[model samples]
Target: MLLSIRPSLFAILLPLLLSRHLPTAASRPAPPSDTWRSSDRFMDAERGTHVAGLSDLKRYFSRFGYLPEPDPDANPTDAFDDRLETAVSLYQTRLGLRVTGKLDAATLAEITTPRCGVPDNATLAPSRAHSVGRFAFFPGEPRWARSGPIVLTYAVSPTATIHYLPRGTVEAVFDLAFARWAQAIPVQFTKTANYESADVKIGFYSGDHGDGEPFDGVLGVLAHAFSPESGRLHLDAAETWAVDFRRERSAVAVDLESVATHEIGHVLGLAHSAVKNSVMYPSLSPRTKKADLRADDVEGVQALYGSNPDFSFSSLIESDTTDSGSAAARRGGGVRSSCMGFLLVLVLVIVI
Candidate 1:
C-alpha cells in the first residue's frame, strides 16, 4: 500500500523521526567571506595566546558537538583556555584537518563553508555512535522496511522554484541521483507525477516552511531530508542550484545533483559521514560537484539495503564478505522491529 500521509501529520511526526539530529546553524545569518579570511582578526590570538570571543566560539563549537556544555559557574574570558583548545582540536580532527588547536586559516575555511542543513552531530546520540563503516544512521535507525520487491515512488514538486534550472532538467538530475543509488543497492526509485501519493516527497521551500527546520538564505545550508518512512526531502529555494558546472560557474551554483544525491542518502536512512570524500559528508563548496559515490558510501548503503545482484563487492574492494539474502527480509525485519518499539506511542496518540 502507498503511504500518503498529509504534510500536517508529517509535521507532527517530524520531531519523532528527527529527535536525535541537532539543529543546523541556519537561524543565524551566515557571515560574509571576509569574516573568515586568513588575515582576519577572528583568530588574532597566537598559539598559547589568550584572545577575545573564546567563550562565544566555545558556545558555537558546543552547538556543533565539538564541545560539551560550558560550565555555567566558570568565569568567561577572552583567553584561549585549555577547554577551548581541546574543543578546537577535536573539531579539526573530526573534519580531517591539520590537528592544531589553534584557529588556523584552513580550519576557519571549513567552519565557514556552506553545508547540508543536517547537523554535524546527533543531539541524543554521541558522534560516531553505533555506526557501520563511515556512514551512520539517523537517531533511531529509521529505514523503509520492505518485505518484498518494491519500487519506491518519488515526486518533485511542480511548485519548485526552477529559476536556475528548468523543470525537466531538475527532474533528470533527480533521476540520475536515484539511479546512482539503485545501481549499488537493491532498491529502485521511480519518479511519479503524483505529488501526494508518492512515497518520497521532494520540494524546495524558503525560510519558515512549518517543518521546524527553516532554510537560511544563500550560503548557510543547501538542503535537508527526513529519515526513512517520513519521506520528506526539502531544498532551500534561495540557493542558485545548477546541474552543469561549466555553464553555471558565473553564479557559483550549487550542484542540484550533488545535493540531491546526498539528500537521497538521508532518505535511504544514511546520516552524514565523517569521511570528507564521501558523498554523505555534510559540507560542499560552491560550484563543486560530488555526484560520484566513494567506497565508504557504497559500503554504507550495502550495509543497510544489501548490494545489487550485478554489483560485485570483490570487483570494487575486498573487505567484508557479501551477505547474499533478500533485501526485503533485511528491511522488513528492521521495520517490524521499529514498529513494535513505537507501538505503544502510536496507541497513545490514537487514544488521545
Candidate 2:
C-alpha cells in the first residue's frame, strides 16, 4: 500500500518529525486546557455519611469555609459526599444556602459556577512574559526557594479576581482581615518587609488551570495548592463564591482574606490544627470573624517565623478581644483561651 511514495509528501513529513524533538521556544503549556483532568476519585469519600479521606475533607470544606463536625458513627450509606449532594444539610443551613444541607442541581450549579475561583482559561496564550512575583515549577521537581520568608503569586482568572477583593471596600476589609492575622499571630507568623520582593511567590488560579489540579465543577473538591515551592494556591473557579465578609452581620457571607490567610499559612508550611479557635482550623464557620485568629494561630505561626524580628505586631494581636476595629467587630465575642489547645501544641511538638 504505497501511501506516501511522493517526494513532496516525504519532505513535508520530515519537518513535522523534527519539530517534535526541538526545545520549546516559549515555556509553560501553550493550551492551558491541556492540564484539566478527571475529578479526584477521593472526593467520593466526603459523601458525608461515612469514612472520609482527610484530603477529601479539605477539598469539600474548601467550598464552604469548613465542614461542621459530623457523626462519623452515622451510617455510611447516608453520609458520604455523593454526586447528588455536594454538601450536608446542616452545612447549607449554617452558610445560609436554603439550609437544606442537600446540594441539589440548582444548589450545585450555584456553588460550581465559574465566578467561584481562579479564571476561565478557555484560552491561554503563552503569557507574553512572566508576571511579577512569578517563578518556575515542574512536576516532581524538588524545592528550590529559600526556606525562610517568601511571597507566593499566581494568575487569578479575570472572573475570579473579584475574590481578590477588587472592590475598594471589600479589598480594605480583606486587608484588615490579614492585618488582624498579622497582629494576632505575630508571635510566630510573619511576612517580609518587601513581600513583593520575597524569594517565594504564591499565585492563585482557578478551573482546570495551571498546576494540574482542576476544579470539579460543583461536584467534588473545591480547591488545592502545592506546598512551599509549589507556590501555587488554586481555587476552583467553578465553585460558588461568597467573598462577602459581613457574614456575622448579614445572613450569608465569607471573608476572602480569612481563607487567603489560612491558605497562605499552608504555603508557609503549617498544617491544620485541631484547636477549633485557631485560624489554622481545617474548616471555618460562617459565624467566625477576622477576630477569630486565636492564640493557637499565634503559636502556630511563631513556630515557623519566630518572634520579635521573626514576629511582632502587638501583644494585643494575640489578645482574646479588641475594641479598636469596626463597631461590628468590637461588639463581637471576647478572646477564647486554648488551655487544652496550648497543651496540645506543646505535646505535639514534644516540648512538654
Best by the lDDT measure: 1
**Which portions of model 2 miss their true places by more than 4 Å?**
1-160, 163-174, 177-206, 217-223, 239-252, 290-292, 309-352
Candidate 2, 264: how far from true, in Å?
A: 1.3
Q: Give each model's whole-structure lDDT.
A: 0.65, 0.38
Candidate 2 whole-model C-alpha lDDT, 0 to 1: 0.38
lDDT of 1 by residue, 1-352 (tens): 1112233453443233212211232422233332233432222211101111445556557656767766789855555568777877777765667887766545544664568877656333322434445576777767788779757999998875545467788889899999989989989899899999999998888767788877655555679998888899999775667666555533335778889999999899887776776789888766566777767788777777888998865543432333324222222110022233234335535554
The lowest-lDDT stretch of 10 consecutive residues in candidate 2 is 16-25
For each candidate, give its TM-score against the true structure: 0.66, 0.41
lDDT of 2 by residue, 8-41 (tens): 3433322222111111213111213322343352
Candidates in order: C-alpha RMSD to true structure: 18.6, 21.9
Looking at model 1, residue 283 earns an lDDT score of 84
lDDT of 1 at 1: 14
Deviation from native of the Cα of residue 319 in model 2, angstroms: 4.5
| Reference-based lDDT, residue 161, model 2 | 41
Can you tell me which runs of candidate 1 are displaced by over 4 Å?
Answer: 1-63, 67-86, 122-133, 313-352
